[model samples]
Target: MTGSLTAARAMAAAAARLRAAGVADPARDARLLLAHAARIDAARVTLIAPEELSPEIAERYEQLVSLRAIRVPVSHLTGEREFYGRRFKISGEVLDPRPETETLIEAALSEPFARVLDLGVGSGCILVTLLAERAQATGLGVDISEAACLQASANAVLHGVAERAEIRRSDWLSDVAGRFDLIVSNPPYIALDEMAGLDEEVRRHEPELALTDGGDGLGAYRRIADGVMRHLAPGGRLLVEIGPTQVAAVIALFAQAGLVDIGIVQDLDGRDRVIRARRG
Candidate 1:
């Protein structure tokens, strides 16, 4: 923190500062931020541990740590997040891609589909990853927020899938046309009452529209269900990420929508994380 400070010493000080500020993984954050400040991969942090940081890098690290202490998300600070093995450019305008949503990705890739639709495509991780993995596939990704649509579009281009993926702004399926063999969503399922309970990073930094439906949390699902049948091809599939406690309600909603073969997929933590259904 002072003159001629080595990377190891600076990280130790930064970790202590983060720990005192209630960061959950202070050491990890310190290492990552140091790497970012030094313009090096995180894996190289250890190699530079004993070397003194340049005044410029040290100043940059100080600013990053200051923002992080206030609970700004690391992805926002780094300007990117990795989802489904791909890096996505992220901002406060969109929700950070989550690991649990990968459950939906796995369920989606379990079958073959030449066409896919992603609803509420906050960062386009789902649609873009699908197209990247399946070279023959093309997709449409829609979000109500224009900012989210732009974020998704950038990610699609970043992942080399922009040519095959279309990003648009639409409220659920309202502006969408054409049937698809697959549809996916990680909608705003958090209830209004639950907003205050979220972490500071999510509650303060991420977009509210990408986190909550401003109601009982089933609003997005209801909208999607109402229009799904009209947009789904025969035997097409629908996959959605959901909260652990939402299994019964989501299943019932899908069933009422006349979707059959409904089933759940759990995340690595074994929580009910995704619901998959097929058009009858």
Candidate 2:
């Protein structure tokens, strides 16, 4: 914690200290948080840390360190996470976007869909990234949590796609109108019974509303399928990220709801992470 080296060197040394403190991915998280405070990338820290460390920068690193010691997510500490090659802001009010969901983004981008819907669009990473990539597309994002809705709205504007995206506070699609060519959701698919078994970093810090659907993991899937059935255009697709274990149940849920061409999509790790189906 004591150092006279440049800010960059100090940050790296501090991150090594964090690794000793039992933080997983300590260097990566520490480097990212420090870079945010120093207004530089983690790689540049090696050169910059040779310069004198300002009291202000030292204080900022102290705060970020304190938060991480308690298992606070790096995204929460840095206020941003990169997904699908874009950065999205995150806070306690919304679920921090996860890298795995980028698979859903990739699936959406594979097709040339013009209209999309993102249910439970926490922080708006999925929708905003898609719309940003396909500048000609228009979309709607719905979230049951008003705070999440606000965060998604902010992300939309941040990505310069607010004009083409409308974010709303709606339970599923209760308040949304019209149909979309594609619908995507990475909802609270964790079952309530499994909450206690998860790592404390997840159960203790992540928003429960974005982590579990209360009754079972499938509640969100049911709601999503119902909405897609009601609002998806012919040949439109619904791509949803599912917990690896829930693939079979979610696939059946989609089939029961009348969706066709049901299939499981794997993630970078080859897990059955997404359930995609086309409305016939």
The lDDT of each candidate is 0.92, 0.86
Q: Per-residue lDDT of 1-280 in model 2, one digit per residue for the tens?
A: 4435566666677687778778888878777877877777666866775677677787788788878877888888888888887888999888878788888888888899999999998899998999999999999999999999899999999999999999999998889889889999988988899999998888887899999988778898887777677799999999999987898888888999999999988989998888889999
What overall lDDT, based on C-alpha atoms, would model 2 receive against the true structure? 0.86
| Candidate 2: regions farther than 4 A off | none
Clash count in backbone of candidate 2? 6
**Worst lDDT window (10 residues) for model 2?**
1-10
Number of clashes in every candidate structure? 0, 6
Best by TM-score: 1
Candidate 1 Cα outliers beyond 4 Å, as residue runs = none
